[model samples]
Target chain A: MEQTSGTQRLVLVVEDNPLTLDAVVAALDEEGYRVRRAVDGMDAIGEMQQEVPDLVIADIHMPRMSGGELVRRLREWNVPVILLSADTNWSRTAGVVFVPKPFDLDHLLDVAANLLDEG
Target chain B: MGIVELLGVRSAAIVPLNVAGNRRGVVIASSAQHDFFTEEDLRFLQAVARWVGALAHRAELVQQLTAEAAERGRRLAADELVTVLAHDLGNYLAPIKARIDLLRRRARREDRQRDLQDAEAASQALDRLRRLIADLLDVGRLDQGIFAISPQAVDLSGLARETAAAFQAGSNAVRIGGESPVPALADPDRLRQALENLLSNAVRHSPEGAPVHLDVGLEGNGDGRWAVLTVSDQGPGVPPDLLPRVFNRYVRGSGSSGLGLGLYLASRIAAAHGGSLTVDSPPGQGARFRLAVPSGDELSGFRGEAP
Candidate 1:
């Protein structure tokens, strides 16, 4: 099992697209990380209320609160974010990794690994 | 003057108000007494015309600014709509990609060669679709000066066969014929994508049961030695009016149920690889697309005519 900070790492993936969420969660799970799923930013917030994750991967556009809003809320918290975006409007949020849509799964895994390792 | 005399006007002074080279209007002063109007009165009228012109200029500026603001607002709304739509389309593509990745992983783990190849092909096709969705925002990725390829010596004939095998399953049958060992310095995945786009376009246009054909070979001329892949179909060829701009972004045929990105992206992929994608269609015969890249020896590091 993979460990970060001397504990099992938890990654919360927030995407309105069900398949993308499934893909991200599955890929992270394959890497031996504990992954949580959320449909949008509001859902992500609900998950955070239960437990704050080590890392958050969220899409920019969604039904309820957007990933941008979610990142804004997490600004007070020290959790790192990986913003998966297909929209050009994705801003450069500090301490957030940006991955364009239709990305290679390996590349995304590498990014997640680097983020976790660096922390 | 005759009309003025008929109205019993003895003296008349008319001034054409020319302000900033624009003739605003005419001011007329008449009196029963001859030469009753003075130059001072005419000068005053001309000054008023100048004031009117100044007001008119300001009003015109305001109108233009309003129009421009409205146009900008419209443009912003349209852009937002397109981005939202493109993002939704991307969301739909995500699942297909996820399934493909999982299939690929499983195939590799099981050592199923055929399934692995099929999954890889599907992944590449999804890659092209993702680009098409992105192109909805950028219109022409080339216009943004975005052209990058990872090139190596690859067998063009094998690529053609694999591409044909992966693509020719459903709507129409594709027959492959070409010379083997046709090597080129190109990105195999991108090259295959371009070929698939052409093949699918052929399939879509062809009548039921007409086989789409893919052929690969080598050619040489003053341009240079080249490895070429050609896809042709026995369908109603491209119309003459659309031929010149066939590869232009967003140019679609009548009743085309596509985003019109396939051919444009294919052409861009070819150009990025320092190659050309040309189409030949004679009236009602059919369409033949030829894609050619510089020839290279397998693993020779021959960097002739590569981008």
Candidate 2:
């Protein structure tokens, strides 16, 4: 689903559950950014292959590939990323950011805007 | 021997200690005089030596066993902490956060009443999280052997419907059946939590579009009548190896997502109610869990009228 794209920032939200994917994508769209969705890391990677997203927000655990692996690969791709999870131990890479799961919607939106300098 | 020679021993005997069926070392006794030991003394030393050998072997075996047990416990705690904390909490927290956030967005743009429409849904999700946290706290209390349940005359059938309804929204795949007014003596809240655990487990493993079935009824034998609730799923059955310890805390199957507290807590709740929770899974067939508790009757001072 394509959001407003007014800011024209293409944010890709990757997760396993469809409901969560829709929820986050809708939020980003409402914030005047275009959004894409992926079911998991592998799917997100495939999306990146087609067209690199300006920003990425992903969950850490999923089938096939995880968001952690995706973040590691995104380092070379130069995409600003936010990893989300209920996890306690995985570390954020340099230039990469994180959002804990059950994250506040406003906080995530602000973090994305700050990363993209939307303000 | 070198030490004995240095001590100028004129008489000496050596005994080999067998540790775990292998000779580990020798014990030697020496004296300066040739008449230091009588024949009986030598025999006694031999007998004592055998006993020492047995003790050495037993000690080594015990050390190895302790190490193995500790390693197993360590692995389980690690797996449980990392996976359960992430997967189980994630199950509720992530989705709840996502849904609420979406609703907030909708409310901002549309009528506030629009978001209020889903308030019940969000509240239910919050309640689920509350129950999870409560169960975790109960687990700690259980460790202290002080966890308690407040039993009531609950209509098992109604409880099943309410409990199943809470988890049935997303997929609406839960199917309920059997006797409608199954009555039992149980802590309604805790009993509902146990049923929720079973339903959650069933829904998770069930393939998309598969049905999760919950049945409420009664069974009887010499032990008197009991109310029984069974939750079954069409998902791939529980693995054979995990069958025995499936209800053990931190005992989750490969690729399972959840706190791993569901079954363990459910079983504990069952026991607390003087009931039992059991599972039967045949290969290639989905798993079925049975929860049974003593029934409530008109003569038992049940808060609800006997059905």
Candidate 3:
């Protein structure tokens, strides 16, 4: 659904757990962005092929494909990606923002908005 | 033989030379006349041989005991150093974690998601710090012979597969190849920790999209059997000079980060379980680390309880 108050910006949320994915999608939806969801990296890649999102937020650890793999694959797209992980030492990459787990939703939204604005 | 004849000895008293239960040779004393050496002379010669043998045995034992005691002292000093460092760092990290948790909760309650996210990041960093401190403390405990290991039968192949799967990432590939039901006698948690350390090191060294292979199976001869877990990476292999000391405390490969305690603790854990950790790396062909622990039957009379 497109946001009524702001310009429609699409975001892809890639997380394994249903609860976390739903919560994140809901929060982004409330913030007036068009949010799409995927259960893991492989699903997210499939989703991106259909319609590339403005930003991608993913978890580092996942089954089949991990968030780090997803980020590496998306590097060519240059689409801003936010990585969420418990590992504090995930290497920094350009056009990527790291948001650690147990994260504040508002801060994620802010980072999303800022990245979109920069574009 | 010639020397005895040259001495013009017609009678001789011979006593076997024994030291620490091993017979070396015989000590012989001769007299110029036949039947010149009496029973008393034979007894005296025997007594001299026994005294010299006993003294030599005692000297050897003393040397061995002294060397062992010195090694124990060195280990104790190292453990003490690690304990002090961990304690001081843990004291600093505990308050940081608590304060971050408080700030995060406040941020959530006030709908300040940005602040909450920042606090969350800080909390995660603190959590990493806490884990490092815990590892350091475990090394200290292991050094002091106080690391607990409760052994039980476990399917080692399955455990190894699960651990390798856990380390799978986009940048590095992890594959587990082994037969299932590779039974072992081990403390499951400690074994898993050792596997994790090896896997992490492999992943860290591997290039993007390179494979880190983990092979598990049984190894050893009829004397004993070992459940072998090997992790090999396709990255720049360790230098020949550094291979021997890779598992030493605070020893890191070039371009590597961290305190270099991962392999050290992993090795200690393996040793505590009557196992061994070894590495092999031919330059330009990635490094391979093998952890071998005794199987259930081989662990007979093995007691790894913490002291």
lDDT values, one for every candidate = 0.79, 0.78, 0.77
Question: Quality of candidate 1's docking, in CAPRI categories?
Answer: acceptable
Considering every candidate listed, which one attains the maximal TM-score? 1
- Global Cα lDDT for candidate 3: 0.77
Candidate 2: tens digits of C-alpha lDDT, residues B96-118: 67667677667766768757657
Query: Model 1's lDDT to the true fold?
Result: 0.79
Stretches of candidate 1 off by over 4 Å are A1-7, B1-36, B140-307
lDDT of 3 by residue, B22-105 (tens): 997788987899988878998999999999999989999999999999988987787666644553453344335545655676
Q: What's model 3's lDDT at B33? A: 90
Top-down lDDT ranking? 1, 2, 3
Query: Least accurate stretch of 10 residues (summed lDDT) in model 1 chain B?
Result: B298-307
lDDT of 1 by residue, B1-307 (tens): 5887788999877777654577877767778898887889778877776777778778878999999898778666666666677677777877678778877887897999999999999998888667666655545334434335678888888888888886656778899887877878898867887887898899889889889988888899997888998889898999999999999977898747778988998898888889999999998888999998888754454434322
Candidate 1 local lDDT, A1-119, one digit each (tens): 34544248888898888778888888778667888888988888889889988888888888878565788986666888888876645634676888877667777778888888777
Model 1, C-alpha of A53: deviation from truth (Å): 2.5
Expressed as tens digits, the lDDT of each residue in A23-44 for candidate 3 is: 6776676567788898888898
Among the numbered candidates, top DockQ falls to: 1
**Model 2 shows how many backbone clashes?**
0
Cα lDDT for residue B129, model 1?
67
DockQ of all predictions against the true structure, Cα-based: 0.41, 0.35, 0.02
For model 1, report the TM-score of its A chain. Answer: 0.88
